[model samples]
Structure formats: C-alpha cells, structure tokens
Target: MVKSHRKDSVDAMKNAAEILAVDSEIISRERNKIEQAKYNLNQLNNLLDDSIDDEIDFLEQLENSLKNPGDFKNSLLLEKLEIIGSRQIPNLEGISLIDSMEISYDWKEAVRLNQEYAKAYQIDLKHPFIAMFSSIELVEISKQVVEEFELLELDKLDYAFAASAGLIAGFIDAIFVGSIKSRADATGLQKSVDKAFDKIVELYGKHERIAELTNQQEKAKTDSSKQNIQNSIDKVKAGIVSASKNGKIVEREWTKHDSIKWLEKYKKVGYDAATNLKDGSFHIPGMSPDNHHLLSLAHEPSLFGLLIGIVDQITGKSTFIGNDGMIQRIVTDNVNKELSGNMVTQITQACENWFGHIMSDIAGSSGSKGRGSGLPVPGWAALQKLQFGHINYSERHSDVTIAELSELMFKKGYDVRSFSAQLIPVLVYETLLRCYWFYKQHFYYGKDLKESVPIANNRELARLLLISAGSFSTVDVTHAIIKSVPGSPQFIAEFIMTVNLPGLVDLGFRSFQNIRNEVSHRKHMENIYENDILIEYNRVMSDPSVL
Candidate 1:
C-alpha cells in the first residue's frame, strides 16, 4: 500500500521536541541522538498512513511551524544546536541538506493553485524567490536541519545534491531582500523562528483579506455581468450542437439506381437555365411549369437544411423585419479589439470582394463620400453584401436562364414564358435566403454548459470549419438582407445594368413593389418569376471564392 506523507510528517513533528536537547560538538555525548533519530524516523513512517488531506494539512503546518525560531529550541535539539557555532547545513543520510525542504510543487499541477494564490494574495510568481522553490528547495532545507542535528547518517550523501535544498533555506540564508525570510532568520537565533514567520503571514493575511479574500461588495455586480456573457455564449453553442445532432437538413445522392425514379421526377429538366428550378431548385418542372431555370443544375444528390449550425455564436441581434426580411446585425463589444475603418473595409471586402465589379458597376448612384461612399451599393452595405448577393444569386436561388432573366423586367405581360422563366427562380432564391436567415439564429459559443452545448467533435480540425463557415455565412446573409431592399436595389442594380442584365435593376426594384402588393392584397404567397432569379443565385453557390 502507498504510504501517507501527511501522517508521516505529522508523526515527525511529535518527536521534534525531544531531539532538541542534544549537543552538536560531541554527537555521541548527547543523549542517544541516534535513538532520538530512530524515533523521529519511525514517527514519519507512521505518519505515512494518513490521508492526503491530512498530509496537506501537515504540510501547511510544517511550512509554517518550521519557520518558528523557537520551534526546535523548545526541545533538546535546541540545546544541542545552541552549543555549535554558526555553520553551513550539511547533508544527512542519503538525502542532501537542501533536498529536505518543501519549496514549490510541479508546474503543471501548481499553475491553477499558483494562479489562485496570485489572485487572492497579489503574489508575483516571476519573483526569483518563488521560482527557486518547486520541490528541490523544500527537500534541501529539511536535509540541512537533519544534518545539523546529526539526525541522519550523512557521510554517504553528495555535496552537489546538498546544494539543491528547498527555497526556504535560501530565504533563511538572507538571499531574499528586506523580506520576511531575512528578518525571521535573524530573530530565529533568540526567538522562535516558526512563530515569527506565521505571525508575519497572519499579519499580511489581514491586509490580503481586505483586498481580495472577502470579495463581498462587487461580487454581486461582477457575478451578474459574467453570468450574462456566459449565458449568451451558452445559448448559442447549445443551438449549434442541437442542430448538428438532429437537423432536418438532409443531403441526397443521385445515382444510377435513382435515375429510373429521376426520369419520373425530372426528365425534361436538362441543363437549361436556372429558371427550370423551383423553391429549393430541385427542378420541380411538372408542378412549376417550363418557364423557370435551374439555378443549381447537377446530377448529384444533396440538400443541407442547416447550412452550418454555428453561425449564431457571434454577437448579433435577430429581428423579423417583414414577411420575408429576417435580419441580424452582428456587432462585437470588444473594446480592446477595435477594427479600424480601413480594416473593417478590408475584411468586409475580402469577405465579399466578388461583388466588387457589380458593386462599383451596378450601384445606381454614387453615395455621399463622407459616409463611406465611392463604393458600389453604399447604402450601408459593404462589398461583403454585394459579393454575398452576387454569390447567393448564383447558387440555390439562381434558376432563371440568362435569356429569361433578360426579358423579366421589360415584358409587359406575366405570360407563360415569364411565369416559367421568372417566378420559379425568384421563389427558389427567396426560399433559400429565408431558410438561411432562420438557421443562423441558433448558433452559440459554448460558454455555459447548462445553456450552451460543448463542442463534441475533434476540436482543432472541426472547429476551424465551423468558425469559417459561420463567419462567411453571416457575412453573406447580412449582404442579402441589406441589398434585398428596394431603395438599395439601385445601389447594386444600376451597376449590374451596365454589364449583363440591366433589366434586373428593374426586376430587383419590382421585387420590392411585389412585396408591398402582396402585403396589401394579403396574398397567401407572393408570386415571382423563377427563371429570372437563379442567374444571381447559382453564381454564388457555384463560385468557391464567393462565400
């Protein structure tokens, strides 16, 4: 069985008084110092059976009591020590003098303890005295006292090892400046050294209590604040974990076996325009008609409901603006990590630079320069919004054929061609955006275990993807929400008008008018042209660089 260090240490203290009477000069002349030593060793052996808590208790006492100048003086050992002139402590038994002391513990294990100590006592670890302590110093001093008392047979020990004694010895040796160590050691010759050290600590403890130990008043305030921050982070992470665990989002695979069934679903849905697509761009040709274009045209099978379950983690306010406009404005409260205008613009640009040409080229008006103007679509929407809009338009939303998207605005009648071309893609794009906006609401940072779910996968690898995806997704959605507004359509519309589909400027504008019309008419679902929509939607999903 493993021995208990605490029990052994406590037992050693029981016999310390008896060993104090010996004379140092004639070790044999003393009253059986060997016998006294035997008793002390046996006590240590007995103490070993005690529990770890007891050991720690003994250690605390040992640390304090040993410093008392009169601790050993009260016993026979003091008489023995009194007879000898001042001399350097020597090795004892197999243990060196310095090795007997207890300075500090292991760094890995003690870091938390040390941090607590520092916070509670304002103690600085970088101080040299603290650094020298970790185990060697403690052992060293114990060996020294033993050797000085001739308690152990030291002729077998090495001087090199003796030099590595506990930190307390160094403090005892006047190494530390006008600190407690020097004063205690100086007074130790006449007074009880251990008591002096304890008194000094007790006195200091009083002051430390006033500063940190009590923690009465502001704790309520700090606790409330910390709770608020933690709760927010927890709520977000929980949502992500919950979604990943049970997501309605599914990705399907289209293989040879499914093709027989595929023809039943979509045989004529070739790689035509995105107008061939429906709400989810699934190519619902029979139900939606032939006017729409397929924004996402692939032989593959996959559909993800929750784009990434980690977007809500960041700071933002989720608000329902209208029937179709649910938006979140991400903002950071970090005072230390402020992003400069140039930095914000750069990051925003990097996030949405794809829309650079469209933004610069599409904006109907050059906004005022004082408020971040000269940029495209500068109605509070950054290049990120433009890129996001550009990319989103290309991907799941992009179902309209270029030709159909071309005819969307100028066409006088919402005919069969317009219905097939415009309504389908618009439905697809709008649905995806609405779904994405809804999904981003549940992200959390895993702050509170009770509120936020912990990251359960491979931490380093998986977290990176999650973080990137979350950030980019938020950036993209923010843009879509901002630019989708009618006033801002000219913001990017006029720019796009110069390039490919100038009519989209009108269509983008018309989408807003349609929204109002639907609201006034209380339309069950707002009507739209699918074919004309996917051009912008598919561009986003296909471009790896966009999102």
Candidate 2:
C-alpha cells in the first residue's frame, strides 16, 4: 500500500512539473507577442519615411527625364533591348519602379479603397500614409513639367500631354486634399478632445488641488512620500505638456480647412479636343484602353466613383476617380508583427487625421496665375456633404446581428451605439463581466453545493478570484471567472441581464464598469466570436434603447 501511494505521489509531481512548463511557455509567448507588436509599430514608421523618400526621388528623376526626352527614351530603349537579349523581362526578377501612368492609376485606386474602408471602420482615411503621398508627388512632378516645358516649342501631341498631365495633377491634388480635411474635421476623436477643454478649465481653476499637493510635498519626511510627491508633480507637468501639444496639432489640422480656397481659382487649361483619343493622339506605348476610359470619365466630377472602378482594374489596385491613379507602395517585410493595443487605437485616430489632411490638401485648389476656366473645382463643403453621404450609406447598409448588439454594450463609451462597426471590444468585455459575476454568485456566494453547478474542487481559489475581480486588469478577472466556471454557459440567455431581476441587473452593472476599465486601458479580447454569445445577449437586451 505504501509503495503504491509513493508511486501515485511521483506521478502527481511529474504532472505538476509539466503544468508549470506549459504556464511558463504561455508567459514567454505573450511577452514575445508584445515585443513583436512594438517592433512592427517602429518598422511601419521607418518604412513610410523610406517610401516617401523613394517617391520623391522618382519624381525628381521623372522631371529630369522630361527635360531631355530624346536621351531618356534612347536609354530606356537600350535597357529594354539589353534585358530582351538576355532573355529576361525587365520586371521579372524583382520589384521595379512604376512608370508615370502606372503611378497615376495606383494613386486613384488607393484613394477609392481608402474611402470605401474608412466608412466601414467608423474612421476617415484608411489608406496607408505612404500611398496618400502619391498625390503630392504627382502634383510636384506636374508643376515641374509645366514650369520647364510649357513654353518650349514642342510637338503638338507632346505639349498637350505634358500640359494635360499638369492640369490633371492639379485637379486631382485638390480633390485629395479636400477629402482629407473634411474627414479629419468629422472624426469621433473630437468627442474625446472636448474633454481637453474641460482639462484646460481644471488647470486654470483655483489651486485647492495644487495647494493640497504642495502641502503633502512639504510634509513628506520619508523616502516613499517624497517619491510620491515627485511622481504627482511629474504627472501634472506631463498632462499640461500633452494638452499643449494636442492643442497645437489640432490648430495645425483645422487651419488647412482654408485649403478649399484653392478651388475658387481653379482651371483646366489646354485644348478641349485633347480629352478625346481620336481628335488628339496622346497615346503613350504602355497606356491601355482602360486607361483611356479612366481619362474619359474624368470630365465629370460626380463620376469620380465610376472612374475609380475602371482605373482600379488597370492599376490592379483600388481607384478613387474615373482616371487611373497610382500610389506609392509599402514594403511589408518587417510589418508582420502584431500591433500593441495602444498602437491600434493610436493608428486608428492618427490615420483618420493624417488621411483627412492629405485628402483636403489634394482637393484644395491652388491660386495660380495660369488657372484654367474649364471645370468647376469641388469645394470643401461639397466634399464634406459627400463624406456625410458615405457615412449614412455605411450605417444604413450595415447588417446588425445579435453578436454585434451584445458586443456594442462593452465598448469604451456608451456612445458606441452610434457606430455599428465599433462594437466588438465592448461585447468581449460584457462577456467577461457577465461570466465573472455569474461564477461568483453561483459558485462562490451560494451555500448549497448540489444546487449550484459543480466547478473545480477548490475553495481558496474562489477567494483569490474574488480578490482578483477587484483588480485593475480585466483580463485577470476574466481568466479567474473562466477558471471558476469550468462548465460555463454557452448561451447568452444563461447569463445575460434580465429586466425583472434587479439584483442580477445590478451585478451586470458592476461587471459593465469593470469592462469599461479594461477598454479605457486598451485591454483587448484574445479570441473573437461572430454569432454565438451575441445570440444569447440579444434575447436579454431586447430593447434597442437599452443597448
């Protein structure tokens, strides 16, 4: 009997060791995930900067090439022959620089995709930052072309092409800039920013708070107390600095709203016959039929969406207007890292503002001396109406499921009901809270063991869970709840808040607070479900107003 008992003890010891190893591995993996996310954030910034530099270089080269067209064409032809002689296509081996037409196609597509995704994501300007800069580069290139070759005695076709390129670039730039600024001004972040004004009020308030802190600092006789005072002061100083910086960024962004003035002096110079392929032969060798279609559609400003669709096909990317537009490319080698939670929120907010400003700048008309009186430039107000129309389209078209409804309850703010796409994190938080509360009430607080559902054979674990429930980390509380209810309910009805049960509803309210804490701190859900718990959630919060 003793020998048998000793053998059982040895097996238990081995099992415990294995469990420890598994836990250690999990911790290591999480740490690596966090580190990788940080690495990706840094790499994204560096990559954007690098891509912008390359784009600038290409524009400079293109400008130079246009100045000496004969030499440039001869060199390109020679290079092409050399590659063909070697039995290798020019673009077969590696990434190659896209030509002017290709760039134009890509820029349009990027803008189109950006508009489509931005609405879906409840944010503005979803395109990659580097991609947006393509408009700026195109405009710069066109300006250079116009400056150098506008006066030169060139062939009719060549001069028309060059002049058209400049005029087209100018018009497109105005559209891009206008779109960006409108989007930025209409962000949900402005709600958060309203608190900045409140903060300013607090800072200017009489120093009862400051006096209390100063008194505490003077009375601090111990190392810990002195350290505490220094920390408090540092926090105060940091908040002030952050408020000041944020104010400056806001000012800079809004001042560009005046960019719409660019439209007031807009013009489309050159021959009206230049728009047609038959009347004016402006065909470059690499340009396709789809490219011509895109250009043809550019005559009407309202058909920009249709233009984007045609251009998107040729560019093999998304497009904005009917003309084939090209954007800068992003190198994604080091960007595979998982994003940190804070980084995700920052990216969401910053991209909206960044893209908004860019689109605004693009659409902003320049007050140039050579303004053509061909077509009317769409002003910032018109662009804003377009954006509002898109937003309404998204809201109306979005399909709301039980899962989406449930998820909506746990978002960082109660205002999430306004945007259907912003519902997931809130849903996960609600699940965590409900699960924790149910586990606590039935498993911990309940007296009758048989009446309550059976869980792990541990009492101290319940105590620890209760204590941890009060912790700042919702994830920890969630884990504790999951552990306590080993046989957790699969359906939302099993745990969702009910109208008649005031006591149960109160518990839900407390849990909801916990969820809010987690979201505000950028804590996120590990796993996602689309239609499962949400069905259960819908059964309980049947009232739309309650959600």
Candidate 3:
C-alpha cells in the first residue's frame, strides 16, 4: 500500500510541475503582447506629432503669403486652406496668442504706438507714411521733440507744442527722404508717401479750425501745426493696434463693397474688442530682465542719439515754413529738392535703431519682479536707496531727493505718460506693488519692527501668514491698518497678522491713480494736480512704522 501511495504522489508532483510550466509560457506571451502594444502606441504618437508639425508649417507659409503687398489675390487658395483647417487642424487662437507674446518688445511697442498714431490722426495704419514709421521711429521723434523744445528754451509748459511740432516735422521729413529719390524724381513708393502726407496735412488743418473756435493765444496756423504733432503720435498708437490686430487675419481679396462692409461691421462691434485680444500692456516678455543692474544695462537709452546723429549727417539743407514757426524745417529736410545717399535705407536704419532703443527702455523700466522684495525698484538707484538708506528712510526727503525718486519711479520706472490707456492700470499696479514692498520692508522688516516681515508675492500668502498666528476678523485688521494709525503692540501684532493685504496693495497703487487717470484720458499736464497725491504719498511713504 505504501509503495502505491508514493507512486501516486510522484505522478501528482509531475503533473503540478507541467501545469506551472504551461502557466509561465502563457504569462510570457501576454507580456510580449503588452510590449508590442506600447511600441505601437509610441510609433503612432510620433506619426501624429510629425503630421501636426507639417500642417503647422504649411499653415505658416500660407499666412505669410497672404500678407504680401502686391496685387495678386488667392481666393481659391484661401478657401482650400480654410477647408483643410476646418477639417483637420486645431483652433489657432492660442497659437497666435503665443506668437504675439513671443514677439520682441520693440515690435510690441511699435504696434501699440501705431494704434495710438492711427486713432489720433483718424487714419489707417496701411497708409504709406504711417506704415513706414514703426514704434522706434516714434521714440526718435519724441526724443527729437523734447530736445528741440529744450533748444528753444521754451517754458516747460510749452513742451507739448515742441513735441507736436517735432513729430510733424519728423514724419514729413521721413516721407520726403523715404519716397523722393532725387530732385523731381519719385520712387514707386512716393505715391503712398504723398497720399499719407496729404492726409496728415488735412488733419493738421482741422486743428487750425479748432484753435479758431477755442480762441487760444496761439495762432490758428501755429496751433494746427502743434495739433498735427499730437495727431502724429496718436497715429502711431493707432497704427500699432491696427497692425497687431490685423496681422494674423488672412488677407482676402476684397471688393470695395466688401471693404466698406468690413469697416461697418468693425464700427458696430467696436475696434477695441478686436484689437485688444490680450492684456493691453505694451510689454515684451523675453526682452525684459528682473534684476535692477541687468535692466539698467539692457535699456541704456540705446541708438536714439546715434540715429539722430546719422539723420542729421545725411540730411541736406532745405526748409519749409511750419505752423508754430519755420522751425518745422529743422526736422523736415527738402528731400524733393535736396539730400543725397540712400535716404530710404537711412530712414529704415534709423527706425530699426529706435526700435532697439525702445526695447532696451522697456527692459529696464518694466519686468517681472525677482528676489529682494519681489518688486521692481527704479534700477540701481532705488536699489541703492533700499540697501544703504542713501535717501534716509525715516526723515522727510529733500525736494531734490523727491524729484529724483519721482523721475525714477514715474518717468523712467513706469513710462507713465507714453503708453496707451490700456496699459495705465498695469503700470499703476506695478508701481503700487513696488511701493507696498518698500512699505513692508521699511516698517515690518527693518530694525524698528517687533515681528519678522511676512514674505509674500500675492495677497493670499499675506492672509495665510495672519490666519496661522491667531484668530482675527478681516474688518478689524483693515480698520486698524488703513483707517487709523497702526499703534499698540497688540494692535500692531493683530494688524501685522490680519491687515487687508489687497486693500493695502490697492492703497499703495492709489498714489498713482490721479496720474494714471489723467494720462489715460489724454488730459493736459496743467490739469494734473501735482501736490495732492504726491504730498499724501510722501507722507505715507516717509515711514509706514508710524502708521
């Protein structure tokens, strides 16, 4: 019986071993199938990626072809492309936004200034002279205008007149040099330039009419010229907006009626919605630097002087009597009769250089904040003031000191008056953020403070820090910090813990509200109340510890 049981056990063991081997083989086959599936999936993914890339490349080429200036129309091509896009391609709005974001700062500014220019002159950007002058050219004209006003020793009040005069002169000169080749000879481009010039002149004439109506001290002729100068700037702004807005839209062959209908549609819908597809700040992302030292180096008032000098050198003497004075002759050369060399190329080069200068300026003036308060300081000067207390943090600042800081913060730091209304809020917010950093660092973090400064970039971090310490109501914290002076150790502690970070931030930004409002509305400097806000700001910024 024992011998029979042993034989059965051996047979059972043999069957079990065979069953385990079969199971192992089945598992191996399944693993192979899984590996093959993954490989196939990866291969399919790569193929899809390649196909998408090819489609995008083809689309890019088509877009470029559509923008070409000649009379060729591709109605069938556009239709075919649209059909293919609708069938196979993804929505390109995000892609276009990314492309806009990636554009150079100079390009962005040029677009913005073009919009302003267009709206000011009530002209389209496609008009020849308007097309010629990009963002950099506007900066050059602005610089020239300011310099000319300085040379005239005009009262600072008359600087606006100088600027306007300078702009008209510059535009007319650019048109002449750009379009007229030699005496009595005109390039094919000349017609567009002439048309643009006539339009500008007509617009300028309107200012004379307005001046007559208002009965201002300036003569109608002078006022018209001055008004034309402003109109030129407005044209630049408008041109920028128009270009950026229309740049991506595939140009289709349009009948006169089609064009009129398109304009009517835009009028009804409003151009603002179409043009301002993104936040309207004239900021170029990749060009700007967060570091103060780097920013200063980056933006260093590039090429404005060089371009001016070059234009001056190449320009031949020819003067035309202008509205304000024969002074318009200073900027406008008689390219129709005089001036030599490739004036077109020279003007082009000048525009390019000016664009570079504007980029550098944008880099220095505005950028993402970094360490050291996570707020933009007015370059190295403000940094110095922050680090070493060169401007005495506790005491009342001298007029000179205040002026310096004001220039640094308002003029160089923010480019307050130069930008579009859409960008005012952005500039104002940034300025306030910087001010908040200054307030916190001086009062909360400096040696006088009883508690350590709360490190925060946004308001939520501030709230979190307060809530973690103890129970507190938002209302109590806001009242203690803003409505009344910050005092009493317990109240200070609570205020430190519970103050409305957003409100405080808003208050800091509020200092620039008046200036922003004035600039946004295109109000004159005389209308701006210099003392009211500045005085309050000075008191608040002098020392937040007292508050």
- The candidate scoring highest on lDDT is 3
RMSD of each: 38.6, 44.2, 40.8
The local distance difference test score of each candidate is 0.29, 0.33, 0.34
lDDT of 2 by residue, 5-67 (tens): 656545443433333333343454466666766666666667667666655655665677789
Better of 2 and 3 by TM-score: 3
Q: Is candidate 2 or candidate 3 better by lDDT?
A: 3
For candidate 2, give the lDDT: 0.33
Residue 249 local lDDT, model 1: 47
Error of 2 at 342 (Å): 27
What tens digits encode model 3's per-residue C-alpha lDDT throughout 1-547? 9679656545433433333333343354456666766766776677678677757766666676678736435764566566555654332211111101122245346445444544553443333333344467768876775544322222442333323332332233233222112112333333333233334433333333233334432444676676765554354333321222445734232222222222222222111111222453422221122222222221223343334334433563212111111122133232222223487875665444333223222322112221011112223222222322133212233232432332233222222111111122223323433344445556654734323233433232232222221121233243445533444333332333223333334334443453354354344332232444345445643664732
Per-model TM values vs. the true structure? 0.15, 0.14, 0.16
lDDT of 1 by residue, 505-539 (tens): 32344445545544643332212212422344456
Ranking according to TM-score, highest score first: 3, 1, 2
Give the poorly placed runs of model 1, Cα more than 4 Å off: 1-288, 291-457, 486-547
- In candidate 3 the C-alpha lDDT for residue 245 amounts to 44
